[model samples]
Target: MSLRPNPPCLNPQTPPPPQSELDNIRRYDVKAIANYYRRRPWKVLGRALEVLWSFGFFLTCLLWDQWTHQVEYYKRQRAEDLRELLTKLGPTFIKVGQALSTRPDLVRRDFLEELIKLQDQLPPFDNDLAFQLMEEQLGMKVDEAYREISAHPVAAASLGQVYRAMLFSGEEVAVKVQRPNLRPRLSLDLYLMRLGAEKFGRFLPLNLGHDLTLIVDEFGIKLFEEIDYLNEGRNAEKFAENFHGDAEVKVPCIYWQYSNQKVLTLEWIQGFKLTDIDKIRAAGLDPSNIIKIGVTSGLRQLLEHGFFHADPHPGNLFATLDGRMAYIDFGMMDQLEPGTKETIASSIVQLINKDYLALTEDFIALGFLAPNTDITPIIPALENVFGSAIGQSVQDFNFKTITDDFSELMYDYPFRVPAKFALIIRSLVTQEGLALSLDPNFKIVEVAYPYVARRLLTGESPQLRRQLIDVLFKNGKFQWQRLENMLSIARSDTKFDLLPTAQLGLQFLFSEEGLYLRRQILLALTEDDRLHTDEVQRIWGLVKDDFRPQELVNVAWNAVREFSLAGVSTILPQR
Candidate 1:
């Protein structure tokens, strides 16, 4: 069967349903699709054949160019061809291309540059069809629902196209209408792709350490969620809730009355894309500060809230005129379990410590390795891959370079990216790419480490506190320089609490969990039973400037008063 375009069929306009009916729209469920197409053999076969016809020739051309060693000669042409082919294949392929754009290790530079155009540059579908679909979904005339709306789409993307509209209340909003026939097209393509992966894996010489079909399934699940406009609205609200009271971050409010399964209405933002460095500067905002906000917010999403916006391409992130960072397009989102979040945070520590053995364990804990897999040989490979990149100040580390090297390592070793981590890697890599686009010298680790440092120093979570202890004391010895560095970095964060940190330090120093820390401090201050004041003097010298004279007196008075009250009670309060 040869693939051909399907004109969007229009559904008859009807009256708007009640809120309860809209809420009943099917939500995202990955398990429901696991064996979803087993009975539809003919449908799967037809779609599979259509896919083969569409991509088979392209793959053949690629293999031929490689075989003749002429790939460099025709690279640009091949890239253009690949982009057009994916676009022709519809939303599913377009999404896959966008995901591939961030992977430097998987896709070459020329092809990656081309694939990036897929992010927000896809061709718009028929505007008339979009209007028809909106009316059908919202059960109201376009003019009745909006005071004014764009005659044409303001922007077009894989799953939907966006229109600028105004409410009757005089508020501006961006109305997103889903592409016609998106669900069935996506469903058919995903099944065919999964089946192809399963069948082809038996013969292909590829060893990516992960099952390709599982990756396809993961992609399908997220894509399904993305197509549901209602789910996207909920994701935006939840993201706003997580970032409540954050002055530097902005999330648009959803207009629930005008939104449903096929249409999304939210506050219209007038801002420049973070990648637009020139406009950002013209608006009197520092691009560097904007980059910091992006990286910091991304860290909070992944490490702190365990929820993250997976697709953070240039289009989805904006710099508002007021100098705050605004995030849009909440369609693609993911969450990490609490344990998974802690493991990822610990992986960062292992990378910094250059403990490849522990890092290997982290990968296993993250599901990149099987429980019974032998990691003895993988440790040295990991050390070789990450040692130099992280050996210097972590600021010298580059994500793209590391990813390229790691990709090769995955092919050679037993390393496979877990299905859940696909978007995490994509998000991190895209953020780095976005930063580099704005500033060639930008190092994501520089901005990212400060947030992590603040979390470690001031976070009250028991798990995080334990990790901090591990970072400070290793092999029964205190790492004073590490402590000093952590404090220095954390001090730069505006939210870092100086007094609370001091209190926490004292509490840890005297608590049971602080036994190891106390012993290490004692060892640092004494040698062969002779006490030395040099260590204590150096510490006081480092911290003396941080304490005001009045603050010191207050702390003294509080301690003395408590002690005196306890003594009086012991001696005289015998009743």
Candidate 2:
């Protein structure tokens, strides 16, 4: 793709947000909120009454359904009622419903099926107001800027709605306009929710190991980010950069000239929702392959880039005509702190290795367990919870099932998801749900393990290199099959190169960290005081087909070149 200095937009001079909208961009602050609402007691009272009334109505309907349990009929009816209630309750509750949809542990299966609809089924605001705001933010009349625009929103989401439009230049685009007065309403609901979580959270019939208030606060922060169209535009650009040359993934470009705090314009995509299996198949695309792109791309985001779209529901993802998984709505994106990504990757390795003790420590290190908390009791619980779930094959391992069991374990123990990891869990769970929609028997780990294996095999970082060693060697014994398995899996990835992997292996085998590994290799080869060349011959036999002699020579030459460059650079003066 060719780079442009400044992509033109409908409005060359988009207006900045007013003072009121600017105030909404601030971080979540409970003290400031309480103080701000102190002088507006009437507003608080009115919203509180409204919330209570809505909850009462929802509960009454649920109770009535329970009283008349007419087999499977009422069950579906109850789920529908819950979906409608959340829709009526507005965006904050809608978001909560979306989160609950991914938690098989919290919601019944039927309700989960219904709640997922909330992702894009919310009602849109007035068309007149939406168009007017689009004009006002862009500083250009709608007709003058766009040759044609949709009469109604193409899709209505919790925070905003998308309209398909065409520019005067005949370029197709998607114009996303935020709902008017969204900030104040969301802020108020979040404040009220936070207050309730602080005051009466414990009394609820819930077993989350963390403070509910913190979760509310985190949600509030992301909600604020989502409302800011400019922030989301920047997020989109960054995400695009992260997957710059990746063929399997696509991210829409932001037209900055026509975008501001409340208005966003981007490339319009003609595609099918990931859940639309029939449409996907009709388009000559394989649903399973589309899911693979989604899973692999998701893994790259969380593991490699440490930046990811936290909200990846069906509506926000689409299977493009060209077989690329396009990600939309960059709002609600999160960044993993340094080392956190490696820790997560290591946990996956530990899980596959069935080292429950190490996995328990990984949780503590990841902040799922509080410091100074005793973990002796937790290790066995984790083992028992995951052992049966991970049964014969990774292909049959379901993430939701593990989380369901994990929720019980968390309730019994002091396992709490850190605020930082809340969205991580939600994103992963939602991605898994999306995959299951396309392929019923899909296992997240089936795709995830291959990606992890590829990373472990060729990763240059010391931490990842150490993990590679950990996978290959167990209890000071060299595991030939483990090495063979990793190589087999890693080679399956398109980006995997055998020569570089072998080069890294040789480099590490001689490095300081490899001292223990070298000792193990020597011990294995000299077992019973007799040199055994069988294992070495076996590994060579496995890789000989792909590891060409020319590639080995190239690896040697490149290593020499790198070493020479390093020596020369060290002796030269600092810039």
Candidate 3:
């Protein structure tokens, strides 16, 4: 049978609608359609040619590898060629390359390294054009806005250029002026890239575990957000708020009056780059301490506040003479939802405890796997990766090694790294590499453990609190081993006290809330309808010794007896 649908039937006496009526009912403009066909052909042809050239270059590289049987050499050469092509393509592709540098899952290590070298250091546009744009954007002449402005840009980036200028009030400021005619060009480029992605997906049998179109859309959104200097100004303010009163961490202040969508004025920071170890040492700053400040601040941003600076490359961070770690260029930042933060926190706890089962559950909870995915295989995978480092000192732990191992597993599993998670990983890995460059012995995990441990012990989240309760009171008895591990981690920081935690636990166990909790525990122990009498006796034994007043023990015992009288059978196993 033919699958084609029947055409619409026409009655012999019925006439079709009038031509004028049909034209009026039309949903599209014929003139616009004709204009699109007329104007778009050349542009489409040009883009197609460019894509064909890129494909040919890569295909040639692959053919060369096949002919010579030199896989690694050709791979490196291909990466270099791709980097050069991306650079020649201008700002949009450069930004895409930068984003790709962060995705180790998408690219090999060598290619990623080469892509990271794709600096957005385009030549500055005409100084007169910049001045004109500043005037147009800020509604004032450049001379009136600044007492002195640099004739040449101090730094020229892909999207904008920064000039060191002094305000009329004698305050030093960095004036960032967006490139002339950038928005239209960027918009067109992004649209073309989206079209290319769609076409590529249609033609290539690719399984990247994510939609290429969606990735391009996300990258475009991020790039557009960076294009708006006002959005960047707000991001700086938000980060400053997160680190308010922190003397060690500094965020450049934005001058709102002098700032607009196309231009930004920020406090000019006079400091050496964090990677400038010699200058930092000459300025009487300890590089190790500076690294600590950076790591600790980053941890607080990631774990405590759930907001983080996504890009902390050396150029974007500086160490001041006063030993403050100053962060600049707030164009790219990431935020973690509260639930993601909790999952990360729990994962840290599980990692510290070496609880592979719990870690597997964390992986599932974090959406790293499908809901019905069997995590048994993942548990062993994690153990294989982290087993040797389980009981090692924090100073001996290497986050990079663990990350690499996990990346290897990710290649084999059906795991998908969410964009935010990938950004977090990229930020940390970059920060760690920078820190190690300054101080070879730097261990980020060592500096981060105290904070993670303290949060698990003191966090007010009900989920965390329940986990802590389960850890301390397992099988209806206090687990001294778990308590010792918690204490050991907390004790490393002299400022963290265990007294408050102990008092809180004691208070919870003595109040009416405690009696209700005890009753619930008894009910849970008997919920299976076949309660082990010894388990009940053991719980009663602990209650008798631990309860402050005798009446509390009696109440707990009576609850157990009530459950026993119900359908729950009390079976005592033979000793």
When sorted by lDDT, best at the front, the candidate numbers are 2, 1, 3
Q: Superposing all C-alpha atoms, what RMSD in Å does each candidate have to the true structure?
A: 7.1, 4.0, 14.0
- At residue 43, candidate 2 shows an lDDT of 84
Per-residue lDDT for 519-572 in model 1, tens only?
667676664476756655665665677788887766544533544454423323
State TM-scores per candidate.
0.87, 0.92, 0.76
- lDDT: worst 10-residue window of model 1: 1-10
Where model 2 places Cα greater than 4 Å from the true spot, the runs are 1-6, 9-25, 68-73, 492-495, 510-520, 527-532, 564-575
Show where candidate 3 strays beyond 4 Å: 1-41, 51-55, 58-83, 102-114, 117-122, 202-208, 388-393, 470-479, 494-575
Alpha-carbon error at 288 in model 1, in Å? Answer: 0.6
Error of 1 at 453 (Å): 1.7
Q: List the residue pairs that clash in candidate 3.
A: none
Model 2 residue 502 CA deviation (Å) reads 1.2
What lDDT tens digits, residue by residue, belong to model 3 across residues 1-575? 11111113211112223333212312222333334434666765676588668768777877888889888767887888788788776688777777677566568888887886764345678999999888877777899889999989998777888999998777789999988766545555666666678777657655345667776666666777777787898898889888887879878878877887779888899899876799999989999989988998998898778888987877689998789899998988888887778788778777867778877778888877777888878888888888765436656777777777787777677787766676788788888988998999888777787777777677456565566665556456544455556656666776666545444444444444345455555555565576656655654453343345655555555444443342222222214
